[model samples]
Target: MILLQANQVARHFGGETLFQHINLEIKDKSRIALIGRNGAGKSTLLKMLAGEEEPDEGTITRTKNLSFGYLAQHTGLTSQKTVWEEVVSVFESVHAIESQMRELEKLISLESEKGNHADSNNYLEQYAALQQTFLDSNGYGIESEIKSVLHGFRFFESFYDQPVNTLSGGQKTRLALAKLLLEKPDLLILDEPTNHLDIDTLNWLEDYLQGYRGAILIVSHDRYFLDKIVTEVYELSRHQIYHYTGNYSRYLELKAAQQEQEWKAYDKQQAEIAKLEDFIARNLVRASTTKRAQSRRKKLEKMTRLDKPAGDEKSAKFLFQAERQSGRDVLAIEQAAIGYDDTVLSEPVTLHLRKQEAVALIGPNGIGKSTLLKSVTGQIPFLKGAAKLGQNVDIGYYDQEQANLTSRNTVLEELWQEHPTFPEKDIRTVLGAFLFSGEDVKKTIPLLSGGEKARVALAKLSMQKDNLLLLDEPTNHLDLDSKEVLEEALIDYDGTLLFVSHDRYFINRIATSVLELSENGSKLYHGDYDYYLEKKKEEQEVAEMTASKTEAEIPAASSAKRDFQQDKEHQRQKRSLEREIAALEEQLTNIDTHIAELQKQMEQPENLEDHEALTELNNQLTAQMEEQDAVMAEWEEKSLLYEDTY
Candidate 1:
């Protein structure tokens, strides 16, 4: 069934047409993605479709009483209720039915206590009917369902009691999305849903949305995320919507072919026009061919000329280069500890990056991945060992926050100020290469959006010509096209790289090695993100297999003459596993109770205004989750080994 439709939709800004002749249709269980470059008016059109704004022309229609949920980018939930209350508020109908069921229970009990079987039977039937309604509405497993979703968003059970108002902006955005999911509307409209999510959470969300019951219309720049969830793509470009019947990658393929065909048809018509014009010009003045010339002129006048084919939006153009090559062993870090003040987030992290190598730094949130990069750049003091640069290594840093930028300076002046000796034309040329032309160059840094600021930072980075670059979350605010351009620049860059990024697609294209950080240290996997995951899974399997190796300790143990030494070793291994299992069980029990305590606190209405308390609680919860993963892994390993011994 068609859930919504927009007919001849047109939108205008001021007096100019932003987009016109736009037609859209959304059906039940549709998975559509809206994609375009920045400033293509994708968000504006989404607002129109979502009924948050009305089109200046045309009309939008929806099914009667059609339900939908709209989640704008970076829009966080603001509520005084605890997380549990806020999410559970979606089930008010279920709650109302529960009240009815409870009242029925009271009447049934009253009659039963009086030994009046006839009256009790009527109340019992009402109770049974109400209970079935509750079950059908998913009232019974609410807590477990909440737990699964909360865990997927990294909320865990503890944060269930945390007031929705007290969460960090990112956390609140996640909660807003969580509440929307619980509502289970017939249509879901999400803009940039992947903004604040990590790889794990992104993975979880991809899985969740794949199984989502309602139709989804999303606007996001994460190509990987789009590829996984969306079945159709709508590209808003050149004041129009172009629909393609596939995912993002497939859309690219079809778009290229379509563009090629358009250009070809236009070129063919232009050639025919040129021939006709030449004939008319040459023969119009000649007496012998006057009739033929007039006929050609009439035909030319009647021809409906094809308009020139438009191309994609203007894209930034720049390349990263190195002035000089660094010596072998571009950078080396041994036993380095990085953190702020007294906190040692991670220690004994080692990396030996050779010349022209690209490495991706990855870790959980708050594990000090950024701190490690900063320590190398001398922005922070190392808590333990130092990062020694190899001979002639020059570092260029791209901070995600763009802090090093001259915010007060205009885009033109920001580049000009950096290289004052260069000519104005030369500076403008470079700025223009980054799509900051004309008056755009005069805009101050503070006025530029996140994507524009990112371009400015990248423009400066491209100019530095440094032999080594340390980038932190380099793809944070970039659109898909800009990210691809940057990826191309970095791929051809004649430098070494050690950058922190959560963009798995970017990492997959750029990284020669993956460095995973932990509290104790960092480990290097000699591959891309996917390969790193493969190696990590293999490590787990290997750990499991190590347990089954006790039989190999003594060949005769499987048969008759097992020596005392062999028996002793087996017993010792069994005893050690037993002790480890007992400790793990205790740790697991304690962590579970801690989580329950947080949930209890979340249940309290008083936590609604306690922002600082919630922040502290979140920090503790992160540690507990990390500990829980480790403990679970260890316990599973030991338990398997213990079973093999028997």
Candidate 2:
């Protein structure tokens, strides 16, 4: 069923059309994503659909009894109540139903005691009807439903008693989302819901939304989340809405095909019009052909002209080129502890980064990823141990907050002042490449939008010519197109890179390895994001198997000692075989680590120049890997045999 529909919807501001003649429908349980570049008025359109804003020229129609809820991009709950109280307030109707049921029970009992049979029957009938209504609405499970949503959002029991106003901005946003889910509106509209969510919470929310009963309209730049949750995409571009019937990746494919077709049709029509115009110009002067030319002119006047298809907006183009190569060991940290003041966030972390390697640092929020970066860059001193950069290494840092940008400085001044020796025209040329042409460069830092600030930072980084880069959430506030541009630039970079990001797609695109930081220590996976997930899953499965094995173990009684002893011998043999398998696995891991190190070394300029040394190292790595594989097969066979014997 269609819950709501928009007919010929158009929104205008300051006599300029943001979008016009837009028509869409929100159906029951539909999953739709509203996607566009930044400042394209996606939020404005969402507000119109949610009835918070009226369209200048259109009608928005909602079905009877249809309920809609909108979670704006920046929503904060202000309340004197505690977190739990604020969340449970969504079930006011359910509580009211309970109160009415109790009142009716008391009334029915009093009427019965007074021997008023007719009145007592009437009260009981009202009570029965109310009870049915309550049951149909799932009123009895209100608290459980609230708990389920809160838990999915990572709001544990400790957070329940906290005052709503005392919570962090991200916590408040999450609480607001949880309340919306509990409200169970017929149409739910969310703007940038993934902004403050960590990976685990993002995953859980995706699962929850998949099972949700109501329709969802979401606007988010998180490609990975959109790909997982949305089935249909509505792209708002150039003052128009275009629909695509798939996820974000599929939308790209179809949008490209569509643009190609549009351009082809447009070119064909323009050619035909040009040919007719030429013929009319040449023939119209002659008396004999004047009548025919007039007829053709009338035909031309009756023809419809196709508008030229617009191409994509301009995007930033830059590369990260190092002035000189660093040593093979670009960075080294030994027994490092990172945090503020006396608080140690992570246990001693030891890492060795090689030249030309791109590492993605990921963990839960407040888990010290950024703190560690600061310690390495000397913004904050390390709590313990040492961090050292290799010979000839130069550091370039990109802070997510753009703290280096002064509010008083103009865009041109920001880049020019960074390197005063460069000519003003040269700086302006670079700014133009970043799409800050004309008066755009004159805008001060404070007046610039978040995306504009990000571009300024990238322009500064590009001019630094640093060999080593340490970035903290560089993609924050960047539009999808800008993010892609940065990704391409980083992928083509010749320098060593270490970045902290929550964007899984970005990690998948640019990371040569993943360094997963935790409270315990960091684990390095020698592949992309997908490989990290696979390895994590395998580790979890092993842990579960070990736990199940321990839980299943039982002790034998005194009477069965003799039989137990006989079985114990078999167990002893099994334990010995397990020890051998463990040893083989450890050896295999060592070989794998060595192979990764060798590969990293092979990419160095010096090693590449010496072909003989590179070939020798490669051959050694190949032999060790072959031996490791053989040992792994033998271990697997022994493990299977041991399981069968047990």
Candidate 3:
């Protein structure tokens, strides 16, 4: 059931090689992830797989009529239509059927009013057929489907009529994903689909994608999301792709073990090689032992040497340090309201931060998580009660937007300006720790990529040595490795932390407590992200229980109704459709068996020598595959009917 396969896929730039000799296969319903450090050509490889970009040297094969949907990273949908129209566009065929059903309904009503029973019956037949088509195409449930997906993306019905062009960047990105999900392509290729998604929406998407019927190929830095959805991991490293079994966590475990074994084997081989070389060198000069030395030399020449194991040599590295330890009370926020001009997004926020406490601020988008952080730093004035810093507390902020980093200065100057007293080499040393070295430091700030700018901002922040850190989406543009590195640093920081992040893994690793912001106010969960989730789950269960009790006490609606003869006939039609689907499936299986047999025969030595026989076998294989495709289409239609029937 391989939906797509690529052989010897390779891509190259102007005069440099990005990756080569790559091979990949995507099976039906496969949940696959491609992960690597930034600049490792992961996005390029994804584009090639989606058929949006051709590989420089490779052949990609896909099943006939394969449908594919690709969501490039950070690319939002540029639509002039309203949100409702944009999403409904995915159901054009269903809409056509719906129109026909409406026309048939009108004709039947007109005939019945004119006292023409026979004409009405004729119209009724057409209506029934059109209705079946509409149901099979999911026209009846289209609105519900769109609403469900939009809800998962945190879009309510009130926003349905709004123009897509007016939506924020994050909202547009979510809308693009929702549209793709509704389309339900055979292969869904997502590049950083978790971007801009809060924890609640992320959880919803993870649940949806887990039950997705199609294959998925994703390039994301969300380790927690990947662990929940993907079953296979592909690592692109040092110009090659390696496949590993299981989820992201399992892949890490397996990869670490595999790398360790490779190193041990490599070391063992080197020792053996050194021993052999020494023996040959020492004994070759001795006439009495010349034959033995020559034998050893011959053996050494025949032995295959193992290539050195590739490592992550370019992973960003840095550390966070506090200049001075703060008092026991690091920060205090009481009855604080934060928002833009004349708009109160959240109110009555109250919190107490102790020294060396890491707190994560989480909420749905537009709830002022980032604005709250800004208010704390005095960048944006609080609408109500202001935050009060503890005795001798100093603050450093990491803006997710990198607003303070808009400069024409070189990367070196960006950091060096903050501490003019430090020597040039000393400034470069700190930059080098963050993988900005040599010519990289001379590059202008505007030319740096999102990831590069993030590192530079961090480099500057780390040097400030503030005891209180306020970060907003610190893992926004980081690759998986860099995010882990930052997480490790923040986890070990001696100062107190209050950051806003959508990265669940990052929050779990760093946050000692969770502060959940809402439109009404803020509530503190005195535990890590996981503990917060557990409490939320318990609350949801209680709410559901209360709802169930209320529902039970209310009067029951009348029992459902269906026309007796019509219902019996519908059941019969459903059974017939199931039988047809089963038959088509069996036919496809038989065709596949024949195709396999033909391929095996073509590989036989006698068939290979006989060109005529080989050609015949190849022709037969192609014919069988064509037949399978036709049968598969029929089976799909029948299955759809079975699922959609009344």
lDDT of each: 0.88, 0.87, 0.89
Better candidate number, 2 or 3, judged by lDDT:
3
Off by over 4 Å in 3: 108-126, 544-646
Candidate 3 lDDT by residue in tens digits, 192-256: 99998988999999999999999999999999999999999999888889999899999999999
**Candidate topping lDDT:** 3
Worst 10 residues of 2 by lDDT: 550-559
lDDT of 3 at 76: 89
Per-candidate clashes come to 3, 0, 0
Residue lDDT tens for model 2, 1-646? 9998888888888988989888888899889999888888889989988889999998999999988889998797889999899988887887898899999999999999999999999999999999998998788888788888888888889989999999899889988998988888988999989888877788889898998899999998888888998899998888888899999999999999999999999999889889889889999999999988888888889989989999888778977899765654679998788788888888778788867789999888777998888889899898888789875689999998899999899999999887899998999999987889999999999999888999999999999999999999988888888889999999999889999988889999999899888888777887899899998999999778666654335232334455767788888998988898788767765765676687778889999999899999889877875776577678667766776665
**TM-score of each prediction:** 0.82, 0.81, 0.82
Deviation (Å) of 467 in candidate 1:
1.1
Model 2 clash count equals 0
Worst 10 residues of 1 by lDDT: 551-560
Error of 2 at 151 (Å): 2.3
User: How many Å off is the CA of 377 in candidate 1?
Assistant: 1.3
Q: Kindly report which residue stretches of model 1 are placed more than 4 angstroms away from their true locations once superposed.
A: 284-295, 540-646
